[model samples]
Target: MDEGAIEIRQLRFGWKPGECLLSIEAFTVGRGERVFLHGPSGSGKSSLLGLVGGVLLPQAGEVRVLGQAWGELPASRRDRFRGDHIGFLFQQFNLLPYLGLLDNVLLPVRYSRLRRQRCEEAPAIEAKRLLAALGLEGEALLSRPVAELSVGQQQRVAAARALLGRPELVVADEPTSALDEEAREAFLSLLMQRCRDSGAALLFVSHDRRLAEGFDREVALSALTAAPGGVQS
Candidate 1:
């Protein structure tokens, strides 16, 4: 199999009719690589991520994941492709308020049979193992409503959910923003360890430069984006 996990070529995207928010000549992320993507606000980081995750399609050029061109897939197939191969951790955690922690973690399995079949253990058991790995344990915490958990704890839960089915790619968007300095470091350590264990490629985005040190590689979105006047590079 080809080693590249993600590849983009001559990509262009914009929300408004004639205003371009992002333009890139090329970008690639290898399999199992942990990459930190840094960009200031309005640098189109989220738009880039949306393209990578198949939430948005580029107006021109290709966005391919695991060798499949996202533009070639129909809308339903793109959604399935995302569910099957990409795990997402949004800034807000995006957990269901009514579901228990375990159920939240098992959500992917419920939606994607590919994810379900990838697990050797039952989905519930695997969920607990992932939760435990991320420092949430015991029946009490597992059964508690996610809305009641602390910001850091909720972040961990989100990480566990993302890593549950061993997806080939994990995209985390400002996951550490709500954490204190100490907690942020701890959470990142655990998140990296889990991603390594699963051999999942990680794309972590943040404005904080301090957290960029331990990543295998880093890319600044500003360098890749082309605004109205010219390309920043």
Candidate 2:
């Protein structure tokens, strides 16, 4: 059988000892699948994404990506592994303010040779192609400082950055929180299309239930996590 893009089995985590933040018996996102994961605030959703991306390790059990256990890798290897295999669209749209849009998108290639090698063309050309695919074409816009772009534009730039080298897995954490309904739908359509074209599995986490349609599967965070009855939101 093919390995899942993400797998969490018998997982337990906590910021403090004996205080469990997340306890999941099992959860998985298959290769090339689009999964919409929804839950209320303070549901350990972002923390779960962190674990999947190898940013955080579970205290017990295992979190694996592409069938490799994250806890088994050293910190440096974990970093390189994540750089090579995982693309993340953070909640805040973490684009550098000092760089232009193209430069911001090219950052991943600088860190991961595998990512750079996966590009069909030179990194710069590929960056422009991704930006263009997201409707940010033209030198005028590509050359502009990323800081000056509007929220929606910046979000697209961030998405372009995450999708740049066709990483196997893309984890988006509340990526459409700021957009209006029309823009959100348009952005999601484009994002899903890009993932499909790249054969990348998408693990999209959001509280907004309206955006759940069109995904291959919809799962609630509450369904996967085993925690106390009430946790602060």
The digit string of per-residue lDDT tens for model 2 on 68-117 reads 99999999999999999988997675798887788899999989999999
| Model 2 collision count | 0
| Model 2 spans with C-alpha error above 4 angstroms | 229-233
The global C-alpha lDDT for each of the candidates, from Candidate 1 onward, is 0.88, 0.89
Which portions of model 1 miss their true places by more than 4 Å? 229-233
Q: Model 1 — which ten-residue stretch has the worst lDDT?
A: 224-233
Top candidate when judged by TM-score against the true structure: 2
For residues 92-134, write the lDDT of model 1, one tens digit per residue: 7569898888888999998899999988799889889988999
Native-structure RMSD, model 1: 2.1
RMSD of every candidate to native, in Å, equals 2.1, 1.2
Residue pairs with colliding backbones in model 2 are: none
Over the full model, what C-alpha lDDT does candidate 2 score relative to the true structure?
Answer: 0.89
Q: What's the residue-level lDDT of 32 in candidate 2?
A: 97
What are the clashing pairs of model 1? none
The estimated TM-scores of all candidates read: 0.96, 0.97
